[model samples]
Target chain A: MGDEFCSCDILHENLIEIVKKKMPQEEKLYDLAELFKVFGDTTRVKIISALFEAELCVCDIAVLLGMSQSAISHQLRVLRQARLVKHRKEGKVVFYSLDDEHIKTIFNQGLEHILEPRGFEHAVF
Target chain B: MGDEFCSCDILHENLIEIVKKKMPQEEKLYDLAELFKVFGDTTRVKIISALFEAELCVCDIAVLLGMSQSAISHQLRVLRQARLVKHRKEGKVVFYSLDDEHIKTIFNQGLEHILEPRGFEHAVF
Candidate 1:
């Protein structure tokens, strides 16, 4: 199946050279993949989506997500470690919010991809 | 560890209610995570990055990434399955490119997150 779809004898040498030059460093690409992996989990994605609405304490996030505070906390730790979220202290309570605006932009971009009409379904395979 | 950081006795009922209303459906969030998971792999990310430069056949992508054609084809199949890439047949060669511009925007957003100075590193823990 693989060969049938992509066994062209002639490689596009010029195109490959250009793309290789433009490709990010291998380490950067690995880090980028690691960052996206943080978003791949449902729990973390929920935490991120909730943070999008407003900053919230762990208890609030747990209640909102209908999950245990521990479970939410675990995911929050992962998110914080990835720097996709940051916490602020107000008196005794710690509130979590997105690390920066770029997170929201990234989430919205992903949402747009899934929400948009996927016209490629009918493309020749 | 979890409790120390988030044992606030009072849940923010009002905030939870508001965010709950604004939160996307569970199915949508699940789909969103699945979509991001497709981008969470190093090979797929490289494939997407290459397509960002120019459309190319599987063999070209294999050469550009310094991977076997079979490996590149596998990742291309995953990308195609997720609708992150679309392919066209020119004669006998199948050339692939990003499904839409949202992919590039998404990649840029992720890039910005990693490239930006993360001020949250110094945030109070």
Candidate 2:
């Protein structure tokens, strides 16, 4: 696994170098920017947080969050498009959860940092 | 530490409820959205990566990244404004590094998840 990660670092290094030479054209930067922009919103973050605990239908999420169904639906749509969350339908209700377990690592780790009193004394060397 | 995180979760629950009851006004979401927006860009991601390892000034970064001095400077300014990076002046050059080691925890953790083979096989319990 460490070996594979080493290869991935090499790839990332090559890619970063390529990006530097190209002067960061707006189109690519815009796409990348859009992805990061998704992370910027607190509403979406809250929605993801709620989803982290259980697979919830939009209405349940709305109730749990005290948000309107319409508002929750809109944010969920954005998350869906970004591949951040996926949903399954059962009868009239749709249940939403994280698209992948890997993503939860990001959210959970971020939350840990934000919520911790002292930051990150626990990294594996 | 775990207890504090548990308390943080309670706080998050209360906050989420308040946000939900309010119907998610655009004003609040916008601020949240803007922060997510910043994370969306690839160039910014690259800049963050370069700084992750060591402190480098604009010129060295420009060389290492193959990006223009102006472009790197601009992105650095944005990162600074976001409190993601801090710079120190030494003679004619300014050296920049990750603002707090806490952030590298985020970046390193994210990259590890992204670049690893199966993703997050080693998360601490």
DockQ of all candidate complexes: 0.55, 0.18
TM-score for each candidate, following the candidate numbering: 0.86, 0.59
Interface RMSD of each: 3.1, 12.3
lDDT of each: 0.83, 0.61
Q: What is the C-alpha RMSD of each candidate to the true structure, in Å?
A: 3.9, 12.9
Which lDDT tens digits does candidate 1 get at residues A68-110?
8779878999898888888988887789998778888889989
Instruction: Indicate the DockQ of the complex predicted as candidate 2.
Output: 0.18
Tens-place lDDT per residue, model 2, A4-55, is 2223234345544654564434454445455555666777877776676666
Task: For residues B18-53, write the lDDT of model 1, one tens digit per residue.
Answer: 899999999999999998999999999888888888
- The TM-score of the first chain in every model comes to 0.81, 0.67
User: Which whole-number lDDT from 0 to 100 does residue B45 have in model 1?
Assistant: 89
